[model samples]
Target: MLCVEFFAILFLAYVILSLSFERFLVSRVKELYKSLIPTTSYINSINQAEDIDILTSNLQKLNSEKNLEIELLKKEQDYRREFIGNLAHELKTPLFTVQGYVLTLQDGVKDKKVVKKYLKQTSKGVDRLIYIIKDLDLITKFESGIASLDRKSFDIVEVVRNVFELLEMRASKDKIVLKFDKEYSKQLMVFADKDRIQQVLTNLIINSLKYGTERGVTEVSIEILKENKILIRIADNGEGIDEQHLPRLFERFYRVDKTRSRNQGGSGLGLAIVKHIIEAHDEKIFVESKVRIGSEFSFSLTLNQD
Candidate 1:
C-alpha cells in the first residue's frame, strides 16, 4: 500500500508541475510582449502555447525582431535630427542676409549707387528665400501623394533640345557645353509627365553647370534598353563626387562642399525634388560618379506603345 501511495503521489506532483510551468511561461510571455513599444512593425501575435518548446521559440523570435526594430528606430532618429538642423541653418542664412541689407539701407545712405546695389542684393536674398519655400512646398506635396504625374506619350528628344536651348546661355556663361551623344534622325518617343520630365532635365543640366569646372562638357544621350525601356542620360565632366557621399546625394540640403554649393546659388533641394518626381512616376533614377573623372545621371522612361 505504501509503494502504491508513493507512486500516486509522484504522478500528482508531475501533473501539478506541468500545469504550473505553462502558467509561468504564459505570464512571462505576456510581460515581454507588453514591453515591446510600437516604434517598428513587429507583428502582434501572442501565443498562449502550452508546449514549452513552442513557447520558447515564439519568445526568441519576438526578442530578435524587437532588437532589430530598436536599432532601425535609433538610426532613423539620428537622420531626422540632422535633417532638421540643416533645414534651420539654410533658412537662417538667407534671413540674416536680407536683414543686414535692410538695416544698412535703413540707416539713410546718401550714395545712390550704394543704395541701388543694396536693394539688388536684398532682392536676391528675398528670391533665395522664395526658392527654398517653394521647393519645400513641392517636396511636401510629393511626399503626401498630392503631386501626380500626367503621363503621356511625348518626344523625349525634342524636350531635350528645348531644355538645351533654354539653358544654352547659362551653360555658355559657365563655359559648359551642352550637347547630345548623337543626332536623332527621328523623334524618340516615351511615355511620362512631359512637364515634370522637363523639370528633371533642367535641374540635372543646371546641376552640372553648378558643380562642373569651366569649359566642362554636359552631354545627354538616349539609349534603347529593351523593347519597353528607354534610357536618358545626362553626363558631365565636372568635379566628381566621392563614393561616400553618393548614397545621400539625393537627400535635401546634402552638400559635399557646403560653402561652395551655397555660393553656387540654388535652392539646394533640386536633387531631392528630382528624386521624388522620378519615384512618383514609378521609375528609378541613378547616378554614377568618379572622384575626378566625372558624374553621370540617368533614368529610364517607358517606351510609348502607341
Candidate 2:
C-alpha cells in the first residue's frame, strides 16, 4: 500500500514538471518573437496562448517576399550593366573608324583615289554616328513621355505604298521585290500616329531587304482582327532568323549576324525604334521566324471607325 501511494505522488510530480517546462518554452519563444518584430501589428494580434506556429508562418512569408524583391533588383542591375556595355561598344566602333581615316588623311598620303575613298568612308561613319545618337535620343524621349503620338485617321495601305516607293531603289539593288499579299481596299484606315507608323513600316522593310536572299520577296498583308483592331504583317522569303534571336531582335544593338550587320552599314537602332513607336500607341508587336526559311514582323493597330 505505501509503495503504491509513493508511485502516485511521483507520477503527479512528473506531470507538473512537464507542464511547467512547456509553459516556460512557449514564454521564451514569444519573447524571442517580440524581439524580432517588436513593432509589428502582427505581434499585437497574437493571443497570450502564443501559437508559435502562427508566428513562424508569418515570418516565413515575409522572408520569402524580401528574397523575391532582392532577386528582382539583382536582375535589373545586371540588365543595366549589359545595356551600358553595348552602348559603349556600338559608339566606339564608328568613332574609331572616323579617327583612323582622319589620321590617314593627316599622314599626307594625298593620292586622289585614296583621298576620295577615305572621305567617302569617313562620311558614312559620320552618318552612322548621327543616326545612333538621334535614335537614342528618340527612345529616351519615348520613355520619358516627351514623345507623344498625334493620332489621326490615315489609310494604312497608302502608308505601305509610300514606304515601298521610298525603299524601291534599295530593294531593287538587292533584287528583293516588295509586294502586297492581295489587293486591299484603299479606304482601310487605322487610328495611329501616321508618321510613326510610316517609320515602323520603313524599318521593317529595310531590314527585310538587307538580310534577304538575292531575288527574294517581302510581302505585306493586312487582316481585320476584331471590331476595333487590324493586324499588319510583313513577311520575308530570305534568310529567316533563328528562334533564339527572335526575342532580342527588337532590342537595341542586338544583331543576329554581327559581322554581316556591321558590313551592311546600319546603326542597328531601326528595330528598336520600331518597337518603341508601336508600343507608344499601346499596341503589341510580334515576330515569327524559322531557320533557313524566312521571318515575319506583325503589329496590331486600332481601326478608325470614323
Candidate 3:
C-alpha cells in the first residue's frame, strides 16, 4: 500500500510540471507575435503605398498622352475642312464665268461685236481654268519627285535681261520700272535648271507687278554670298505682305487678299511652286517684307563650277 501511494505522488508532480511548461510556452508565443505584428503591418503599408503611387503616375501619363493625340487629330480635321472649302471656291469662280458667257452666246445674240466680246471673255475664263489645273499638276509633280531638274550652266544676268525685255510692255503699261541694281554686263554664271529658274523669276516679277504700288520699281540684284553660292534677289517697292500671311506664303492655294483682283492675279500657286523649285535644288529661300515699305524675295543658287 505504501509503494502505491508514492507512485501516485510522483504522477501528480509530473502533471504540474507539464502544465507550467505549457503555460510558459504559450506566453512566449504571444509576446513574439505581438512584437512582429506592427513591423509586418508597417512593411505591408509601405509596399501598398508605393504601388498606388506608381499606378497613379502611370495613369496620369497615359491621360496626358491621350489628350495630346486628340488635339492633333482635331487640328488635322480643321485643316482638311479649310482646304476643301478653298479649293472649291477657287475652281468655281472661273467655271461660273465661262458658263455664263457660253449661255449668252447660245441665246442667239447675233451681233458680231457681241459675239466677239463673249467669245473673248469665254476664252479668258477657260485660260484661267487651264492655268489653275496646270499649276496644280505641276505642284503635284514637284511634290512627288517626278519633275526632274535639268541642271545647266547659264548666265543669270542674261536671263534677267530677257525677263526684263519680255515684261517691258507690261511694266510700261503700269508705268512701273524694272531694272537691275547695277549693270550685270559680266556673266553671272549659275548652275540650275535654266527653264525653271526663268519661270521662278517670271512668277516673282509678275507678282510684284500685280500687287505693286502704281509706278513702283521692281529691281533684281545679285550678290556673291559665298564661294559656291550666289544670292539672287527680287525686290519691289510695293504694298508688302502682312506678318500673318508670311508663315503660309508657300502653302498651295493660299491667298493674302480675299478680294484680290482676279484679272491681274495668278493661279495662286506661284509662290508654292517657287518654294518647291528652290528646295529641289537643295537651296534656301527667304522673304522680308513690311507693310508699305516693300518686299524682297531672295534665294541662293550654286555657282557653275565646271
Query: Each candidate's root-mean-square deviation in Å?
Result: 4.2, 3.6, 14.1
**What TM-score does each of the candidates earn?**
0.84, 0.83, 0.78
| lDDT assessment of candidate 1 | 0.87
Q: Which one is best on lDDT?
A: 2
- Candidate 1 per-residue lDDT, tens place, 223-266, comes to 99976998899999999999999998998888888878878875
Give the best candidate by TM-score: 1
Lowest summed lDDT window (length 10), candidate 1: 38-47
Query: Model 1, residue 136: displacement in angstroms?
Result: 1.9
- Misplaced by over 4 Å in model 1 are 1-50
Query: Model 1 reaches what TM-score against the true structure?
Result: 0.84
Clashes of 2: 0
Off by over 4 Å in 3: 1-67
lDDT for model 2, on a 0 to 1 scale?
0.88
